[model samples]
Target: MAKITKKEVEHVSRLARLELSDEEKETFTKQLNNILTYVEKLNELDTKDVEPTSHVLQIQNIFKEDEIRESLPRERALSNAPDRTDEFYRVPKIIE
Candidate 1:
């Protein structure tokens, strides 16, 4: 028995707002059925003793410790700015 039907393909195409031709619908029905059939074969596997895992390989965090550090002075930080006030950078108004 076919896993997918032409009517089901047409219904999905309608839901997705796609306009498929008769030939395309026929092609997609066969293709989707083949994919489902292949996936169904996985049910025959013996996985009773297999352990479930999120990833195939082990993973570990490789990060340095965070520490407090001195920040850049305001005068030096604004030295390369195109526009600035006494204590802040001046940017063009964006909101009405």
Candidate 2:
């Protein structure tokens, strides 16, 4: 990877919403350059047939089906509320 200049570091910091001091920018510039160098080394590897992995472990779909179950009785659902209308919990109006 090419060495990063101070100008590039400041531009990247602006893009990332970071407010860095001159010292911090200098420090991050060196750190980011080193990280890029490592990534560049990884790009040199031959992995033509290797599959890209999202994680180190092989993961399967872990979600349950979305079918609805019977809901709680209205009285049970409102048991813990401080305020309710005849059929629903009520709250202070938040929208105009």
Candidate 3:
């Protein structure tokens, strides 16, 4: 991999609307290069037998099974509605 140069760092900072001093540019260039070097080292690892996963840990669904249960009656549910039909609440039309 090509080493990150100060000019490339300066260009990126300008595109991001950031103002960096000469020292900051030098620092970022070195830091980016070091990160690339480390990533290059990872290419030497053998991952052929490793299975790809979204997460490192084994995950399973923790949810309980759904059960049928008694619920509030429709009349009681619509008791406080300002406007309601026999089975549902009513609201003013705002789309038109």
Best by lDDT: 1
User: lDDT tens string, model 1, 1-96?
Assistant: 998899999999999999999999999999999999999988899999989998877988678679877889989999999999897899999798
The better candidate by lDDT, 1 or 2, is 1
Candidate 1 Cα errors over 4 Å, as ranges: 45-96
TM-score of each: 0.45, 0.49, 0.41
RMSD per candidate (Å) reads: 11.0, 8.5, 12.4
Best by TM-score: 2
Model 3, CA-based lDDT: 0.88
In model 1, residue pairs whose N, Cα or C atoms come closer than 3 Å (at least 3 residues apart or on different chains), thus clashing, are none
lDDT (Cα, tens digit) per residue for candidate 3, span 1-96: 557788999899999999999999988899999998888887798999987788877888688669977889889889999999779788998699
Of 2 and 3, the candidate ahead on TM-score is: 2
Which tens-of-lDDT digit does each residue in 70-94 have in candidate 2?
A: 8898899899999998888899998
- The global Cα lDDT (0 to 1) of model 1 is 0.92
In TM-score terms, candidate 1 sits at: 0.45
lDDT of each: 0.92, 0.88, 0.88
Model 2 lDDT at residue 35: 83
